[model samples]
Target: MRRIIILLLLLVIALGSAGAVWAHGVKITYTVTFSPTIAIEAAYDTGEPMANAQVIVYAPDDPKTPWLTGECDDDGRFSFSPDPSKPGTWEIQVRQAGHGEWLKIPLDEEMMQSGQGVVTEGGDEGFSTAQIVLMSACVIWGFVGTALFFQSRRPPAQEPGEAA
Candidate 1:
């Protein structure tokens, strides 16, 4: 009887562990390499991407005069490296036929001195370890309790009824 109970407990633990492992769904990782540059994505108030829009960039030293001029791609995304010689705040003016916006891009002194790529990591957004453990323990306890209840309710061994 003791051995049977131990075996049952072991089986429950194994099944519970398997369930916990299966609950951890697929995991994906994304890495992006970034340089000291300004990236802008123009969009309308309705969340529509504004493509082929004129993008005029002005250096920090000379704000009134335009330094660089170009247009955004089809995805309304544009990127440009600031003038390292003039390390400060840059002014970017994005204009279309009817809509226009001004953006300020800042370049620190460290980035100007050492132009090194920076790596940013996006981790897996999933349940914490403690939560997973707690859930697994609850499932195992419930299964064990149910099994014990049914076992206790079984009819005991008895010969043919001779009296009430």
Candidate 2:
């Protein structure tokens, strides 16, 4: 009985600790419009928008300091006009509720002037939604399977007065 109780407690603790990680899966993607402004959209792997999340832009010229900092709008979208004087890869970071994602966009003098809209992917290259869900389920099933295996190997609980 004590062993079973301990196993159950371990399972609960593991699941509780993993809950935060499972909740924080932010992905960021960007698109350059015809106006030279770069637009970004942040969302969870589950396709849910990261509403009102914090955004920080870092110019390539000054990588250490943030060029601009702001929060995403209600739709998880933010746009900023990059400094044409600084020609290189611009970095953007989006963070919210313990989840953060980074994106890098390379813009040279010619590329910025072209004004050709192109959708680009960025941020953590993670598994798809289905893959994530499947992996999580596998982990949970592992715990349950181990617990059941141990429980099965144990003999039935006997009353205190029963003979050995």
Candidate 3:
């Protein structure tokens, strides 16, 4: 019974860690045309496009509700013109499969006047150092706990010359 539980615990840990190694980071880039249109391009870090991904755009004035929602082209590209009345930071999010990223483009009055702005990516974008440390610690802790559990169930060693 004890052996069965220990094996199951180890199996669970193996399966958990296996899935963590199979992920690819997502990347997105954007360009604001002189026409005041924002074009977005989404792709995996491996260079494969996030073809036909879902897109949600939020205007500067209203951040909660989506200002506009659409889908990317086969090339993982989408574009839309911002509202001239709403001049602040425009947020665009692109998602496909299980990957997604947020792009924050601050379009203030000056940028609007110049017809362009510096686009930046935002959000807790990727795993932080703390997060990686915590995950490694958790896996090590599980292995240690499993070892302790396994060791506790071992029978005591007998002397070679002792009678049975």
Candidate 4:
């Protein structure tokens, strides 16, 4: 019948047009990677990591001379172990290309007896859990809002018997 043929043609056209609508949108994937960080970091007063620094150590007896000399790694960390035999006070001096810092460590009876080295520096990890959750919520809301807006703008469907 003519009505059946017309209906099939309209259905084909509608499906073809719907395909065009689907083809109009774009799918873009953005991947973000957060790598794990190394430990033992030195920082300035502003909390910026100090990289490639010169590290020097001085014994309590020798105040004017350096006992040990080394350079900090890329992570701004200069690992060193003090002498257990020299039980007094030890000074550590860290200097970059220009900036510098000095820390005086006391090797008292209790500390020397314990034989445990203290950790003076540490690195700051990435974003907190709350921050990640907030960002994910924002992105989800943006996607949902965009989908709703597009859905509202779509053309209403035509009934089988509706006039053109």
Best by TM-score: 2
TM-score (C-alpha, index-matched) for candidate 3:
0.57
lDDT, residue 48, model 1: 57
| TM-score of each prediction | 0.49, 0.63, 0.57, 0.44
CA lDDT, every model vs. true structure = 0.66, 0.80, 0.76, 0.54
Per-residue lDDT value at 101 in model 1: 73
Q: Tens digits of per-residue lDDT for model 4 on 52-89? A: 77778887789789988888777666556555566676
The lDDT of model 3 is 0.76
Give the best candidate by lDDT: 2
Report the candidate with higher lDDT, 1 versus 3: 3
* Candidate order (lDDT): 2, 3, 1, 4
Candidate 3 residues 68-133, lDDT tens each? Answer: 999999998998988876779899989887689988987777666666555533333345546755
**Candidate 2 lDDT (Cα, whole model)?**
0.80
Candidate number with the higher TM-score (2 or 3): 2
The better candidate by lDDT, 3 or 4, is 3
State model 1's lDDT: 0.66
Residue pairs clashing in model 2 are: none
